[model samples]
Target: MKFSSIIYVLLVFSFLTMTALSIYYYLQIQQDKVKISQAVSSGTPLPDYHFALIGEELDHDYWRLVGKGAKQNETEYDVFVEYEGPERSNPEEQLKLLDKAIKKKVDGIIVQALNDEFTPLIDLAVGKGIPVITIDTDSPDSLRSAYIGTDNYAAGQLAGKALIEDTGGEAVVGIVTGRFNNTHHSLRVEGFRDVIEQEAGIDIVAIEESNIDRIGAEEKAHNMLTEHKEITALYGTSALDGTGISEAAESLDRQDLYVITFDTLEENLRLLEKGKVDALVEQQPWKMGHQSVKIMTDLINEKQVKKIHHTNSSIVRKQNLPYRQDLRGGRQ
Candidate 1:
């Protein structure tokens, strides 16, 4: 009996020793990761933290605003935000950059999760102990740290409400959205549909996808107008959709057709000023960018942060254009 008790005590001590060693090594590994993140490069000290901001496209004006917003606080926060994306809106290319960012072991990642396929990469990043924040578009099913952008459904609802109020609830509606698979675009379309379905006078004549470019949007919008002559009001659920719709409307001699579009890009704002677009469902891409860096900084500092942060969304019209502040810097 005495021998058995002694053996049991010895085994317990050994187990505790192993546990302590494991914890020590784990802590040392974590410290090493921090050191790696802070390493000097080319004899210049690195920022306190390094973050990557990947968006849908590099050349897009709306995305440029997002990048501007993301880099707004680099100096203030003593952090560096590396912003890059594909020249065009390509999910595969975007995800490839995301995977590369993960492999590079960035301190944090802020990205636009284009579709459901982004889930695995986001989860992979989290699994590797790197934090991720979804910007503009979100992967709700993934273990993302937070999402910062418009409440897509609510923004769509706003568009529908604007259309109802502006057109006296008697619009023959047609939609040209960014993409069918993009969660935000789908939510926007769904919200618009739900609202339109409730109104008896409004009937949706046709719906199309823009593929998120001016040319595609123009083609889709032109085709919709030609095929569905009854389409009195056109809603474009992407940034360039409005511009395309405007050009399409003018080309078809349908300038009087009510047009609504997403975002307040320079082109959209120009169209709005000229009365080409009836209303703009404006999203704060700059704000989305700005808040992401702030949130990521907080996250890196071990601060508790909100899981979801919506920037802002509003309807801009010709009447209110004069009263609106200069969005040149997207300061608001």
Candidate 2:
């Protein structure tokens, strides 16, 4: 083939590729617009109150349980509940979804204010006369109508006490959490630190953030064990942390290391049954969802609701594992 012909063919191929890419992105934007339109449409059709629950990824087991509780009360309350959010803990994405819910003018919103940055958005929703409830995490500075979820500080205390008891109040501890800036995780860490530090013999050797990434948590756990050979206990502040810590502990043959974590995930429960995880701090996610809707409904009806509702948190160990029936959290 002639060199000029070859050059011309390459130019055509490049042009076509760029055109295809542009079209693909254009269609993606269009699709997102359609979804936003549908979300906003929920505001219409009077006589039906609409509520939006926006949080972490839809597939997350904890949020699934929350959604289940919300859905269960829909028929009883004569309201519509819609749940949607990014597939990961993205504050920016969460804010965008909140904006959509606000534009939709939904009667109420239940969200996770992962950090204080969400305060302004929550206030915006409240300023629009929409009741907002913070679940899983709370934003006190925001004008949210109610804060419903576990008392993270108390839950952290439970973790600390459990760890001290298991380790005989004398050991090196490592913590794996989702995000340092996360209000819930930070509070949990604070509670744990306060209680654990009270013991003169116990020491916190390392505290790392996994950012809720499974592999990252596992890698952090492994690194902690490698770096601090004296570490005798591990604590996971996020739901995903338990599984990752377990995997790392097993791979490194650190079964002697005591493991305690938050949440009641199936994987974590299995580890508990097998005596890998010493204890789990269980939060009532179902109650968080259920109460969020109820409180929002109360606010919409002009009925006063409590400013804060602290849900139940308990420690689950192997001995009382039979009562684990209620700890099953997920979508119905």
Candidate 3:
């Protein structure tokens, strides 16, 4: 009995020792990883800093511009940038792509923050020591390193101011937005309302949601005009909304109504030339893309970056339309 008890005690001691050694090695590995990350972030000359840009959709013209900007810096920054996103604008799919990027442990990430749904996921990436930058739109609640995009509220105010000026500050206006819950869209609507409502002569009689579809926006614009016959102007908050608004007003043979919108897409410019649309508030998407990568690289090198970086935009009207076209390479 004594001999058996001694053997059992020896075995128990052996097991405990092995467990302690395993835990110590695991902790040492974790500490090493953290040190490496810190070293890279501190500008300790590294060969490669892999960065990924995940956007709402893969095929959109705006996102394409963003990708172009991101790629332009690959040679200059000595980094690799991979662009990926859902085939369409689906937030859930966007989340999956973010997760994949996180799993791959990219050095940094630039994402289009479309909704609050991305907030927690962005936080997760930050927790994993991956720096995140929000582009175009923002995730205000997350620990993102920086935001590089247009001031949406200001853009909306520009739209309203253009309408008021075109109509002598007295016209019934209608509004069409991509989605009500979209942060940027809501901010734009608020800015427009704030400006338009300041003049009692300008009244917004109707507001509609288009889900960012050109056809749906056109139909909604047509219906809004029919329902509110007194409307003398329309504001579209999405890229497609401008063309839709112009088409709806022209279809009704009410070309007298003033129209304003966002972006300088080719379709919007055509309407501008025809005098169907009055003005377009152009967001600098290419700059947003380029700046996003620059800021992310800075963060990876343990450099300080502003939490918010607002790109410049301008109201493209008839006079400057041709100049803008030449600058954008005649592409929408």
Candidate 4:
């Protein structure tokens, strides 16, 4: 072919390829934006302070919302937030990230201390003059500056009460908790059991740990419901637990099964709307993130900082779906 003919053919091919790629992106995929960090270019002025905010599972929608909150006002506070975490829930991995942050000597850290093993590392960061703030989960014995996020015990009590009311004080409850070793989950279970035990009409038929994953939650919930056919309701004490339980219930064709779970994740809310999940424990992760940053800023500024701040939480049911638009957040 002549040079002009060849050039014309290549141009048409390139244009078609570009059009296909654009259509694929705009139609096939839903996109989301998350600020991972403020990259400081060489010779560029840095923010006044650097803060490392570590979370449980980076890909999880609830934690992503929490991270978003922490980074929302980064420019306003004049701080660079390095928000990061493992792709999945791994406490040991989170510990390693915290250690790395400490060695880097970031001005501050906001981390979810999942359990007792995290306490020592938390203290180590504090000893090195790095103000550490705990989020979501707390290391009670650690020398961290402040604690923020949900009051787990109270939230659990709320869940239990919500169940009792929904079930009319009579339910054979099967509990699907995040993890046995996770402190917040333990507290939530304890608080829930205390409230449930007080009511003679309700019985906790079985309890299982999900290891903070949907598959684990589903398998355990499915097994519990199958083995114990009398289980009238399920209480999931983690972000993804409700989704799993809902799936399990649907698979078993348990249309009358009542379900309550932690976090108002978008999927969970959708399940609530479909009547698969009866109630959701509302956690304002965005507020938790933003408020924790504000607290950390006060600490760095040498201003009076409160030792603890609990972000808002409530029990949400299908009746209130229209008013709870803020529950739609982060990548699912």
Candidate 5:
């Protein structure tokens, strides 16, 4: 063959090989782009549907915060959020709301599980193919999809540790919880007991249930303080009960008693500033609300999520109260 002809043939061969490789790479990139688009658009193969969120009490600040989070999710995800609950924390009323949600055929339901007695109703919702996620409180026996809230037991333990640290673990303590049978309250009591039991010289002399009513909590606190004069500390598990305890302590001039409570209501913050309550355990109610709706959205879409999602709780003492206010914007 001539040298020029040989060189021309080699050049043609190299050009064809490079063109083939380029086409192969382009097709591979196109396929990968399609796969990515499907993953982003389809989102876990679950049904696309609306959700209903039922709380024990919708009028309360905490539940309102939860509703706000759900509303934000609804706007962001283009899903409907039906938020309904009783004016007060009534188990029967909350159950009726749950029934209404089920009848409305929402894709998922979120509840606070007013009390453990709502398990049967929760099971019914699950039986109807509507996934239920409990927030704040839960009924363990219920057929719920998941629970998103703070670890009440651990919160109680944190309060206990704070108390022990403040009093050198030898103070006589009293407890004021919202409802005796409520899961959150019960778990907190258990956690407090566990911590106090492990410590030396710290004793929980009296445990009282306030039913989460301010008047009821006040009465209980008054009676308990009158009866247990040696009590050096008081721990209240609920927002209302915490305020009541603080008020009772202030009224009776029990400045010696160290008060540790939960939630950061406006009044609670005032109490903290006034040196009436030594510390408050703050939970991320806003995050709980946001996550609850997100979980419901995922569940409706058949997306797998963690069975239990826990948010952290922090001890807000007088020293750190200002910092906490800056972080959470001085609101509950």
Candidate 6:
């Protein structure tokens, strides 16, 4: 063959080879892009999952709000929320609930721990590849993923500020708490004491524990009031105790005493309306329950969740009582 013709044939062969390779590479890239788009659109790579919550109690309005939030999230995310706890707040019951959830192979667990008894159970859940998150009350020593609840310290501070304002910064205060060891009540008492100590003319005359029970709170409040006749104010760290304190005050006809408590329970709201409890610090139990499930879902899906979520509390008095009817259930 002539040299020029042979060179032209070689050049054509090279051009065809290069064009074929380019087309193959472009098609491969397009295929990869499609796969990624499908994965993103359908969340195909996400794990199938559900979560369970072992709340402190089921019959209480506070826990009901939490369960409502969990159910709302469950519906939104197309996941199951298995909620079960004791009729009353019992650490042993909570542990049994934890065991049941683990046996069911839930994707994750959310706990409203009654006490430190659930620590080992929480650790066991984590060891078995299940993530556990604490809400409302936490077990700090456990291997839980995170805590989602109000800053109890700050809530107490708000309570103290309210008390100070109501009493014009001068009064002997009596404190009613549910449990001495419960983290929420303990932090609240600490914060309240710290703030009250900072202010002049404010003194904590007595601190009483009601075990978060109404009758116990009532008895404790009566004793405190009878013993400390100079007490000018009362503060309760739990919803039940708050109502009990109010009842005790009403029974004594001590209309001059200022009462401040926590949560928006019906009885407490009624007392607020009657000017029995001057102010109540309200926590977002619904938000706690909802966000807890969300965090658990994220953990199960291998997605990121905030290490800590703090829900703020607000002071509810008669002035703002009407607007929060849904939250207070028209208790006032």
Candidate 1 Cα outliers beyond 4 Å, as residue runs: 1-44
Query: Per-residue lDDT tens digits of candidate 4, residues 1-332?
Result: 99999999999999999897566444422321122222333444567888999999999888888888888878889887889798999998898789878877889999999988898999999999999999988887899999998899999999988988888999899999999989999989999999999999999989999988899999999999999999999999997889899899989999999999988887887888998898989887888888888899999999999888887779889998898675674521
Residue 55 of candidate 1: its Cα lDDT? 95
1-332 per-residue lDDT for model 2 (tens digits): 99999999999999999897567556645765676588579864332678999977686888888888888888778787878878877888888789778876888999999987889989999999888999989998889988999999999999999888878888899999988988899999999999998999999989999998889899999999999999999999988898899899999999798999988878778889999888999888887888788888889889978888999888899887786676654521
Provide the lowest-lDDT 10-residue window in model 4: 28-37
lDDT of 6 by residue, 97-157 (tens): 7876776667889987757787888899899999999998877888888999988988999
Local distance difference test scores for all models: 0.89, 0.87, 0.84, 0.87, 0.82, 0.84
Model 1: which residue pairs collide? 69-289, 69-290
Compare the candidates by lDDT and give the number of the best one.
1
Between the candidate structures 2 and 3, which one is better when assessed by lDDT? 2
Cα shift from native, residue 11, model 5 (Å): 99
Q: Clash number for every model?
A: 2, 0, 2, 0, 1, 0
Off by over 4 Å in 3: 1-47, 330-332
- Which residue runs does candidate 5 get wrong by more than 4 Å? 1-48, 326-332
Measured with C-alpha atoms, the lDDT of residue 135 in candidate 1 is 94
Candidate 5 local lDDT, 8-114, one digit each (tens): 99999999988975675566447645755785798834325567788778778777777877777766666667677889888887776777677667788888886
Structural similarity to truth (TM-score) of each candidate: 0.86, 0.86, 0.83, 0.86, 0.82, 0.82
Candidate 2, superposed: residue stretches over 4 Å from native? 1-47, 329-332
Give the TM-score comparing model 6 with the true structure, all chains together.
Answer: 0.82
User: lDDT by residue for model 3 over 1-332, one digit each (tens)?
Assistant: 69999999999999999897567556644764775688689986553787889977777777777888888877788777778887766777888778767877889999988889989989999999999999989887899988999889888888888888888989998999988988889989999999999998999999999887788899999999999999988899988888788888889999788888988766677888999888889887777777777788888888878999998777888999656655364222
Better of 1 and 2 by lDDT: 1
Score candidate 5 by lDDT.
0.82
TM-score: the better of candidates 3 and 5? 3
Worst 10 residues of 2 by lDDT: 323-332
TM-score of 1: 0.86
